[model samples]
Target: MVNTRDLRVIAVLISLLFTAFFVLIILFRGEIDTAATATVESYGLVAIFLGVFLLELLPQYISPHLLVINAIFLGFHIVPIILVSILGHIFASLLGFHLGKVYGFRLVEKLYSDKTVSKISSGMDRYGRWIVLLSAFLPFPYIPVIFGSLDLTWKNFWIFGIIPRAISFALLGFGLSFLTF
Candidate 1:
């Protein structure tokens, strides 16, 4: 359904968006960090939930890891932070899944080389749910796109994607909680 022209246009748009995000971060690093920290402190868990949700929805567009670490440093408990982070990831995955369903192939092609997409597709077929579970914990942000492109069922996505993502977040939260300075 997607053509080369459409893929090129989407790729350009995505690249521009990332460039703009990086530019903003570079230009406003101090102010952004201070504002983010203050906002989390003032609003508490709601801020964390919303922040993580947006980060997950956009993935590498922003660093949610720093946000969560900052939230923990600002005195949010690990349990609630983990819960909210997982919830955000689930919601983000749902969005990505649907997006992939509609435009998975084109997006994947734009994001990865044709050979890479082929390899991933073959691996998904061979590994099935296990791949989904494993991908949940991986740092790679393309997992949801791959799953959606494969047309993976909702049940498998929730089970494999959400569960491992929650566990990973819990571990990350617990580990980060112990850091000093």
Candidate 2:
């Protein structure tokens, strides 16, 4: 008999598994041009949106950088790409926030040692919104989870988190666009 807690965990795990399967398909199928760009172009913004969404939701599995580069490679105009990517990231962060709200510190504990999670939690408490803002540029994959775990207000999270992340992805996308190869 699965209790509610067990059911919730099962749901999260199943979602993760599906995300993993999609990541594997993206990783192993072929070259970026053949597999990734083709898929992005074929599906247009929806594909890009979903790819970036998973990139945030399962940061350990997908490379956010690679997703942006692939989108650029497919000749997605910079503004739309940035907008779609930011929306996806914000949506994923909101999901993580709710998950954190429901499961609390256990989510962080599962990903990191108790000591590490405590330290991070402490830093978040002390630093608050600044930490959330800086995380966008710092490659701190677990920032959303941390913020969610702390039950940071939605207003603060959206304002602090989304802008910096959008700027970061824009810089990255435009920078990558300049490379000859």
Per-residue alpha-carbon lDDT of model 1 for 8-91, expressed as tens digits?
676578667756765675566667667766775567677667776776654243445555666565556788888877777778
For 1-181, candidate 2 gives per-residue lDDT tens digits of 2254664576578667766655664465455457556666768778778877876775343356566665665556777777888788778878877887788877766754555466667778799777778777885544577677787887888788866787788898778678614
What value of lDDT does candidate 1 attain over all alpha carbons? 0.69
Q: After superposing candidate 2 on the true structure, give the runs of residues whose Cα lies further than 4 Å from its correct spot.
A: 1-39, 59-62, 111-116
Task: Give the worst 10-residue stretch by lDDT in candidate 2.
Answer: 58-67
The worst-scoring run of ten residues by lDDT in candidate 1 lies at 57-66
Candidate with the greatest TM-score versus the true structure: 2
Model 2 clash tally? 0
- TM-scores of the candidates are 0.64, 0.67
* Model 1 stretches with alpha carbons more than 4 Å out: 1-38, 43-47, 59-63, 110-119
Looking at model 1, the pairs that clash are none
Q: What's the CA RMSD for each of the models?
A: 5.8, 6.6
